[model samples]
Target: MKIAFVGKGGSGKTTLSSLFIRHLAASRVPVMAVDADINQHLGVALGLDEAEAAALPAMGAHLPLIKNYLRGDNPRIASAETMIKTTPPGEGSRLLHVTGDNPVYDACARPVLLEGETVRLMATGPFTESDLGVACYHSKVGAVELCLNHLVDGREEYVVVDMTAGSDSFASGMFTRFDMTFLVAEPTRKGVAVYRQYKEYARDFGVPLRVVGNKVQNPDDLAFLRAEVGEDLLVAVGHSDWVRAMEKGRTTRFASLEAPNREALTLLHAAADASYEQRDWERYTRQMVHFHLKNAESWANAKTGADLAAQVDPAFVLAEGAAAPQPA
Candidate 1:
């Protein structure tokens, strides 16, 4: 399944995404986890060392061959089709792999800069400055197109995109491209407030919304939110020491069951799929209130009998009180 993850920064959404990838990979699925967020921390969170995490640069590093072709350069050497790396499943884990380009070096080298090519092209090893900021980062639409092509054309059944934080235009664009969208929110009022705001806006656009409240300490807090946010589409995964899972280079179900470093991803997988089957609570949203109020208004108007029942009360009014009962 191609699932997308989105939420505010520091929401542990990326970490959660990592675990799902790991979980799928452990089951022997050829998983390709894309760090759509420019920060590119998935490798670190997955316990890959520098040498191990090094392939990401290639995935985002290359300037598209179309740019080279447009520039009238040789097409044969400019394409990154073969060099982009992918991670493979291993013994109860996953093995790492990359194809041709090394973005860490490619990004640093000056290039015939495409108007948007910003990873700062270079031809070298490490980067002292990694996230030049996504604005400064460049993605050749060709590369993204290639990735999508593979997903549709080949054997990879899963492609998980860990998106950037917030509700920017790019986030909206990314949201549109996916088959399923998962919004990660926290239990705090601020989190719920932001979540609702996005939901209302997205609903206007007809975005099918599913919510996951991460790092929850009290399930009751979810109850409170249900009163306001409509709990039918909401699910909660309790606050575990998620960072501790990252710090220890392991998972508390962060990515796999073998090591669950206080991460709630395991519950996330199940909760995400089972929300419809498991949750059954009355809605407390303003929409429901308004619906019932409108219903009551209709009921009151019906009782008035301005149109129906010939201006009659069930037992009293008879079309302007015509012919009252005489003494029997």
Candidate 2:
């Protein structure tokens, strides 16, 4: 199952995402964590030192190679440069398995130690001086979007992405790529404001959004979240000294996590599993085709000088045990 964590900046979405990833790993679940945020701090949040995290390969920097490898032997794609980020897979295209070995994973993802367990991580990379004035962060995020589009994950395997904060995720079809999205919000009007915005936007698409309250210190905080989010409130995570210490470079063990905070992680994981039962491969394929057509008509056609619509295989369905269509 694929899950995403999103919220307004400083709402602790990244922190919560890291904790959930560690929890899944500690339980011996196969999980991959992607930092799709502009800040790119998930590695550090997951226990890597700043220097070590900074040294890991950035997925955004290797988009061309990723595109080339995923395009596979598909004749619909003229070349790697012709494959835009929104290009959907067709017959002959490579589809990835979450727990299977593939070149794309080898080139971009790295394993990092978290609480004595290894967690695989990939980052969209930070925007550098070179990207100033000429590029948008969305371009870097395209790498993550493409990866999810091509990935075929099982119900037990997980892909947890820490998405860009706020409603910025609505900028592309990427927001619809998750089985569940945990919106982390603090108990404040400003925090719930983003929730309202996401709720309104996600309503049209039937996005499965649930609110996770962060930094809740008392009953009043929980009440504020319940009032603002109502039934959409799934869980509330209290402030934790252990997390603060870990963030400040003080080594801390997961076993030392506050009981309430630990329980919150368990709830989040359970909510994600529930979503998997409702997963629809047909809807997933339709979404991919819908966005592919939109992008092709909007810009990819002229940009690539090919009818990118040919990239969509009408018979394609991304589900377990489904046979992929062969090229005619």
Candidate 3:
């Protein structure tokens, strides 16, 4: 399952994401945690000390290498510059499966030792001073989308991403890459407002947008969420002293998790068994190419649709046995 946790800033999305990954790892399940946020704090949430987390490499720093590795035996992708995010994966392209050998995974994955077991954690990139004026985070997250486009998960394996806050996800196609997206919403008006925005946008893409209500202190808080999101509200989490204590540096161990949060995670795990819909590669590639071409016209000299189509792998076809039509 490719799960993304997104919400308004301060809505506890990262905490929930880290907790879910820990839960899965503790259960002896194979899990990969991705810190896709520009803030990049999922490492601390996952119990990594600052020094340890800082030691891990940023995936975006190696994008050129990763793209080259994923190109594999594909003759069309002779170099990193030729393979854009919309480049469809052919038999020659690297295949990143849950438990098997994949050059893409090898290039980016870093071991995060936790609870006597090692979980693989990969980060997209950190916000840098050099990007203060020009770089969009969308470009950084595009690396994650490229990785997911090649990933193949098994029944018991999971990929959880801690996404950037709020509607910033709309800056790119990364939001559509998830099998399930947990919108961690608070009971405030702004929090529920973000939920409405995501629900409306996701409807067109068939993305499963579920709400996980955070910091519910009473019946009224839960009721407020129920009123706003209706059936989309999957679970309501109560205030957790344990988490609060950890936040204050009393301890680093996650000993007593809130019950409601645990129940929600259990449900999330069960849902993963049947939640994923196998995407049509050719269709997805075409949509991504269209998105890129639209951006290219405004940002670069690549003015024609044909210019974008040339970046795609011709041999990568749809699951329904058809190739994406090249633009004229």
Candidate 4:
């Protein structure tokens, strides 16, 4: 299962991600949870102390992996074995491999647990807000390309992508590789608005979108969210004390998630399973709007077409009987 959790800032995505991992691990199910958020809160949410996490840099670093891409085709991978942590505060594995034109293939080697079964963690690149031009663009795109390449050729059964926050370009580009998407939102107005933005952005990439609302307190709020997000596309999750427990060095599943908590997780599983199936689009259609098509036909009609210059300022178009505008 390749699952992705995405939403704007402060929407409880990290919290939900923690719950999902706890649930899967409790069942002894193998899973790889990738933390894509810039804040890097999944570890804290899982009760891995800040000092411990900081000491676990090798948990997600890959230097030799980067060298392979620079070496071109047939660069031998000395060992494809990803390092796994069996100890507490680091019950996960981190692996690294490279066979492409990406220096950041080294970055995809996320740490996971032996009990995490197939769980992996790839931290988002530490790019800043100003890195939107060619440099960062190609960098993240290359990383995304490498991620897909590795996944298509790997053995993992599931990939839980914790996406970077907001509707940034890197996040959008990363989503292009996902088959389905989960957008986490809150009952707040900004959450609703960001959720809608995420839906529209997902549509632009032709991927189906679902919603998960966290910190929801009232039934009416859930109703309102469902009404806006469509009943089939949304799930409501109440706040859980498990989040605080994890912060205190207890990487345990919240008991609250068992009965009522199970409901949301169950629904989430259905959504995640649907995504896990990996259905590829076989065909596509591209057509102009009917009004635009009609307008085009009218403009091409020699018998009834108005002077083309009428569509614009005649003086500007003619420019005193001048030539065409040159490319800038």
Give me the candidate number with maximum TM-score: 2
Query: RMSD to the native, candidate 4?
Result: 16.4
Of candidate 2, the 10-residue stretch with the lowest lDDT total is 319-328
> Where does model 2 exceed 4 Å of error?
323-328
The candidate, 1 or 2, that scores higher on TM-score is: 2
lDDT by residue for model 4 (204-264), tens: 5466678888777899888878877776456788866555555566645355444767778
Best-to-worst order by TM-score is 2, 3, 4, 1
Give the per-residue lDDT digits (tens) of candidate 2, residues 4-47.
Answer: 99999999999999999988987788899999999989999988
lDDT of 3 by residue, 1-328 (tens): 7899999999999988988887888778888999999788888787777887776677877788777776677665556675665455665666565554454556677777666667888898686788778988877787887787767665577889999999898877778777789999999999999999988887887777889999999999999999999999988888877778766656455446767667878887766555755544555555555555555555432423234444555555523223221111
> Could you tell me the C-alpha RMSD of candidate 1 in Å?
22.8
Q: What is the TM-score of each candidate against the true structure?
A: 0.54, 0.96, 0.87, 0.64
Error at 273, model 3, angstroms: 3.0
Model 4 spans > 4 angstroms off:
58-64, 67-118, 125-145, 153-156, 169-172, 251-258, 276-278, 281-328
Off by over 4 Å in 3: 100-107, 250-255, 277-306, 313-328
Q: Give the winner by lDDT: 1 or 4.
A: 4
* lDDT (C-alpha, whole model) for all candidates: 0.44, 0.88, 0.75, 0.50
lDDT: the better of candidates 2 and 3: 2
lDDT of 2 at 237: 86
Pick by TM-score: 3 or 4, better one: 3
Local lDDT at 281 for model 4: 22
